[model samples]
Target: MDNYLLLKIAHSLPGLLLLLGLLAHIFMLWKANRGGDAAVLQRKLRRTRLISLPLLGVLALSLPVSGWVLVNLVGWPLGQTWLLASSVLFLAVLVLGLLLAGRLAAWQALAGSPAPASLLRFTAAYAGLIVVLLLAIMGLMGAKPA
Candidate 1:
């Protein structure tokens, strides 16, 4: 296989992993939220964080490096409109993701108590932002301009 193929796979795999991880994390959170036992909810939240955080970090780091390699291999200029837009969206996603993580930490800190309604609303909003940004980035990548 060529370098482009290898790099493309490297770039794409992380995206799939990130999407699945996010979905799973959200599902776990939903389940925990629905359960009445505070101790059970806390344990599930901690477990989800422990598994998701490292995966998120790895996906976040892998994306740019692999994307840069793929861009170089294709000889696409960095200033191209699609690439520029994707980069901006990527950064936005990162910032939003960090904010969501902070919110999760705050949720975790609520240990024995139920998560506040405001915090749940914020988490859902942040998660929606991340999903929208990610989809925009995917669109840009798929519709690479001439």
Candidate 2:
């Protein structure tokens, strides 16, 4: 009913959605790769590159804006240690996400050719790092002082 609650919901919802979307994308890509159908793999990669990735990017970008508003609403200073740590982690996630996108684009560019094992491993590792960073950020947010 209040501004804090409203802002909290706004900040939290997209974060949850983004995490879920990323996990889903990872599973989808893994499944497609395991299916051993080049056409399906390419289609999955293209769809993720063009549609899912962009939508997730928008959600990812919205988080800091909403989080800033929520923090201001709560009258918390921006320079708190947890906030700073989370910010660093968030930036790491963003950079890694972009790198992942580039790797996915390379996969898509293969146009149904079999993806290299090294490329697949690198992409998966990047995704794993992003997920870990995101989780760390969430933990920092949760552990912040009331």
Candidate 3:
């Protein structure tokens, strides 16, 4: 209806998409863990991971960019130390996400063919980090610029 609404919408849309994609990736990892043939599960995992790359990138960037814009344009003053800290943490999480994503992509591509136990362990650990990051991001978002 107005500029503030537009800004809030723009920022939240990307953030929500990113959150949704993260949830999807998380579920896929869980699926991989459940009953299934190792090789087939690996193939499916790789396919899902491969497709998630661009989506992750889009979410990773869009969330912060739009969020910052909205906060700057429509949100409260950044004087709140908690909000500022959360913003920094959110950025750190995004960077880690981007870096880990590249590593995960490379690993998925290589390990997709064989599906080693070690690789699955790696996926599990990496997936764990993703979950942590998502939780932190969600917390920071809920904190907002209060």
Candidate 4:
């Protein structure tokens, strides 16, 4: 098999996993928004976290590794406009993802206590950031010049 085929497969499988995890999270949020019980939503969130943890770890590692392989081994240009824009937006999404994750943890911890009226803010933030990250994912896949 060609190395390019292998590389493409490697690039895609993890993306599918990440997309699955994101869909699961969105489902949980939808349920929560429908006034689902706190304990139920929290459990749903935990399940999503468990499903995503390994996939996300793989994503974090593959990014730099694949970028190096593409630009160095395969001699793909790092100076392309698409690559530059994608890189910038990807970094922004990554930072926001980290922040949203921390907030999710805090909200999950709060699940053990009383449900607060203020968790709506966290929910809104998480959803918004996730949408941005999802858009970043689409951008990475599309690789269109900006």
- Residue 115, candidate 3: Cα error in Å is 4.3
Per lDDT, the best of the predicted structures is: 2
What would you estimate as the lDDT of candidate 4?
Answer: 0.65
Q: Which ten residues in a row have the lowest lDDT in candidate 4?
A: 137-146
Worst 10 residues of 3 by lDDT: 106-115
lDDT of the structure predicted as candidate 2: 0.91
3 against 4, candidate with superior lDDT: 3
Model 1 misplaced regions, further than 4 Å: none
What is the C-alpha lDDT profile of model 4 across 84-141, one tens digit per residue? Answer: 7767766775676676666666767776565566665765676577666756766665
- lDDT (C-alpha, whole model) for all candidates: 0.85, 0.91, 0.66, 0.65
**Per-residue alpha-carbon lDDT of model 1 for 98-136, expressed as tens digits?**
899889889999878877899999998998888788878
Please list the residue runs of candidate 2 whose C-alpha ends up more than 4 Å from where it truly belongs after superposition: none
lDDT of candidate 2 over 30-139, digit per residue (tens)? 99999999999988998898899999999999999999988888889999999999998999999999999999998888888888999999999999998888888888
- Residue 146 Cα positional deviation in candidate 1, in Å, after optimal superposition: 8.1
Error of 2 at 38 (Å): 0.8
Count of clashing residue pairs in every prediction: 0, 0, 0, 0
Please give the distance, in angstroms, between residue 77's alpha carbon in candidate 1 and its true position after superposition: 0.3
